[model samples]
Target: MADTALPGTRVKVPFAGQAVDGFVLARIAESEHPGRLQPLRRAVSAEPVLAPEIAELVGDVAARYAGTRSDVLRLAVPARHATTEKADSVPAGTVPPPDLAAWSTYEGSAALAGLAAGESPRLVWTVGPGDDGIELLADAAVATASAGRGALVCLPDVRDVARLDKALVQRLGKGRHVVLTADAGPAKRYAAFLAVARGAVRIVIGTRAAAFAPVHDLGLVAIWDDGDDLYAEPRAPYPHTREVLLLRAQRAETAVLLAAHARSVEAEYLVRSAWATSVALPRDEVRRRAAVSVTGDSDLDLARDPRARSSRLPKEVFEVLREALTVGPVLVQTPRAGYATRLACESCRTPASCPACHGPLRIGAAQAPPSCTWCGTVATGWSCPECGGRGLRAPVLGDRRTAEELGRAFPSIPVQTSSAERIIDRVRARPGIVVATPGAEPPAEGGYAAVVLLDTWLLLARSDLRAEEEALRRWLNAAALVGSTADRPGRVVAVGDPARGSLQALVRWDPAGFAQREIAERQEAHLPPASRVATLTGPAELLEGALAVLQLPAGAEVLGPVEVGDGSEEQRYVVRVPRTAGAQLSAALVALQASRSARKEQHLRVDVDPVTLG
Candidate 1:
């Protein structure tokens, strides 16, 4: 390979994802022995994107995942920053609403209270979904740092950071704080990095990548929604934000507050092992123990029929939704993305494939032949070749379609779709036929006339170990829109078998208990918040060949020849390496590259603490 040198100077460090040339500032004397030893050259950064501590975290993540540190660093640092404030150290703490109203009663309040008071060094809390617990944790984080300490609050995605930012703005004021997210531009991010490294901003609100945020005398590290898949970085050094924060908390000797609607099994391990203490709401308080009807697979069968919506949507759902809309506003929740779930041909029981690439085809026509968006190949015109029958595969549902159906169902009421596209800024403040995606569900136009979870199975069908946890989170999101978000009691009616969903949590308005049971199952399965599991992906043949030479620790076992990608029959392999052997197994597999074994074999992907088992 051509000698890689960054532009500007001889110091070539991995910048963004690619290696670019830059001037290196420091070079120590040589080690006793070495290979690939290159002299350090200098570059003009004018400023560095990552602080030393932050860079170290990337390296730690790499070692943990058996992947390159460069990729992990990319996810943590923003592509750019809007603006960076110079270091201006200031202390701040939790500010309750003027009324002390319900502000002091935020779920994570007690956990933060004990830590700031120096009574607890580490606290783990599992809250039910939609408790505004992240806001509460933000309150505690501010308090911890305000008491002469530093704080880092890392969330799963930029969306969450934005939510927390608004809350922080209202609670902590706009000035004297730093917000770091991937969405921001570069020069600005580097400047923000400088602020944290130099002790300018004592409080940092960032995405999973921000687990590396540098703050001296850190008193707290909080991870919101530990169960969120968004927190699991998709790139190399596939580190989970929760693990990163736990490590940071341990290193800094600061208290960590896992303020999640549901506790993760990995986090439960921390509590069960005495690594951290668990604070949660009672089971009966956070779950819906009441008897409720369920609409599931049976209901979906009816909706999928092309004839079902001919006149005005599925009769049953239409009637239920119609009746609910008359009461106030009806909440309809699909998956998080508007049109992510896809449909397949009913006859073959196989998802329609792209004519050329065979990639999954999305529905584009009403009763029209399905054409692969990727290849433009049209399958048999609405007929199943295998069965000689005309039927639809699974029809992907999104808020757009749901809203359209609702409009048709209730012709009189106005229906609005709420998602990233049509964001409801203050969910507690609206009333309408709010058809929403999971996280963006708008508050009830008057506490939804009724909540209809359009695709209940989608939540349960996720490949992640925390599928149930996520389902609860979505249930809570829908329930919140129906119930009072600002502490007023309310009611919610879900579409599926009340038994299948967190109807108990809704009826009882308890998210804490769901989190508890969810954590227990994860712990039992040796999932994260329990024992760690790593996923290695790439070309199947390459992975298998690599696996052949992989030497895991004695205590660890390989669990699969699990299917990965479909590049080729053996293009992918899912190798489950136990946490104890994670580092060692990954290192060993990587070591096979001494001769560049993977170069011609397959691409290598390592996911540390993977959320999705599939």
Candidate 2:
């Protein structure tokens, strides 16, 4: 059994008089131990499910995120399915040559040409509005497959996966590619994994976890919307999909394409550092593709509609919606999802909070009692803590409330809502209003005539560091669904202060410019993308102990160990360092964790380059 256990094969061995399962990483010629080692109890399977490249990637990811190798492996490789593993492998299908017509529309067709020639070319692709990115990705994948090399594409959600899967089938016949997502049951996912490992499939597409798909002789790794928080793993070590793919591209010399409607600061940094080339449409082409207008772009416009600042639906927005409705369905993108996610005193305008947990209170629907968002406690007879006012007012309007208001304003037109609870995949292109929260907006058949962005202040008012950046990304994503052309351009109306940078970026349809400005601002402030940051969260004593033992790298600065949560004992400490010293910072944190583990002390939660600082 020991002789049959090859690298990547699973085996069972005796450890401290107990049987333990582990993977055979390598077969060493000699052991350093003077005493004879115990023989393996049995080989679980002779199949090398974990490939050598994937094993190395797992180790690199663990080290980069300051996590244990086992933790990273758990995410890289799925749980074994015996029945699926025992199944026979399917034969590989022939892939047709890819047509490069679609690549001609963009300025960076060379990147696609490079993939066809089997050369590694890195690109930060900003997909333009009114474009089908799924089709383009399918073309890239086919180009790689035609060269007899595997391709992997990672999307943000299952809907995207389904869309891309259909496009792949249309481009490259059936059985040429496999879909790998957690939504697919364990058996099906394992079967797909086995197919890839056995070289039965050359193309793999899925969400999040698919970034680690072990495709043999990989030639390209592409990720769409790299800035979406969904790409950040919630598990320990919290490895981000973009970072993981970048590492893989660097190590394997594989082609990488990070495509999105809006650019993330990290992606912008890559372009600035000459690590990746920027692929985007010309400014004039962008304007022709996206027709965006902010409510108060000039003082004369503000003077013409004085109510624009105070009203949720300005006259300009109403005019756009009313005109667009005559042609096709109109999309309304709201910031929140519930009826009233925030309540304030009607008289004093003071925020309402729950007396029990001091959490903000919210109303689920009309005539519904206010409840605590954090503790879920119903707030009966709630009063403002600052003022003695008993009346409550909804300061922040959600999608449901916006839909109700729109329904009243346009009684003849039907109003539908799409949110987390009820997601609409597609809507007919008719004269109706579709109210949807960001990311939940369904694509309308023939495309929406116009998109109205409401409650823009709510999106920008968050205490998060990426509030503006995230708002622009969501706005671009929603606006991209509208169809546009040189003759009949799509209309997009945003109700917000036009002077703000994010709103200005939307008006000009310049996400790349916005990202450049954002990166410069962050660099000046010593924030992420320009520098590295790590957060330590746990009890105060444990966090302090961890910090005390940490060997600080040069130029590293330790910020406050501030109290977190609602007067809880938990505390958080932030460590900032230059981007060049990121590895050193991770190493120090890993050593600190090791020391705590050796002493059997409470471990601190350490996250390097966390997505959110709040």
Best by lDDT: 2
Model 1: per-residue Cα lDDT over 1-614, one tens digit each: 11332221134455446667443323345666666654433342334445555566666766666666556656655443324433443433343322223344344445556655644467776554335665676677666655667778888767678877887777768755687776666665666666776676777888865677777677788888776778777666667788888766665577778766555556666776777776665554443322123443344544664444232234456666655544456667777454433656665676655556876766553455556666767766544445656666556676766676667756777777778776775433233577788878654334454566666656777776567766877676566444433433233445444555355554455455565666667556655544556566665566777677766666665667666555455433445445565667667655655435335654566565567776
Those runs of model 2 whose alpha carbons end farther than 4 Å from true positions after fitting are 296-299, 354-359, 367-390
**Candidate 2 vs. true structure, TM-score:** 0.95
Residue range 1-614, candidate 2, lDDT tens digits: 75669998888899879888778988999988999899988898888878899899998888889898878888888888998998987867778788988778788878777888788889999888777777788888899888888899999999889989999888876788999998799999989988998888879999988888889899999999999999999998899999999899889999999999899999998999999999988788877877998884457666999876668898888899889988899999998989999998998998899889988999998778999998989988887777788999888889889999999989999999999889998989789999999999998887789999998888999899899999999999999888774588899999888889999999888888899999989989899989999999998877777778799899999998788876778999999999999999989888888888888887778899999989
Q: Which residue pairs clash within candidate 2?
A: none
Counting clashing residue pairs in each candidate, in order, gives: 49, 0
Candidate that scores best on TM-score: 2
- Name the weakest run of 10 consecutive residues (lDDT summed) in model 2: 293-302
Candidate 1 lDDT at 365 equals: 37
Task: Give stretches of model 1 more than 4 Å off.
Answer: 1-39, 43-52, 69-109, 115-121, 127-130, 282-328, 336-381, 384-397, 420-422, 427-431, 443-450, 463-465, 485-488, 498-531, 539-541, 574-603
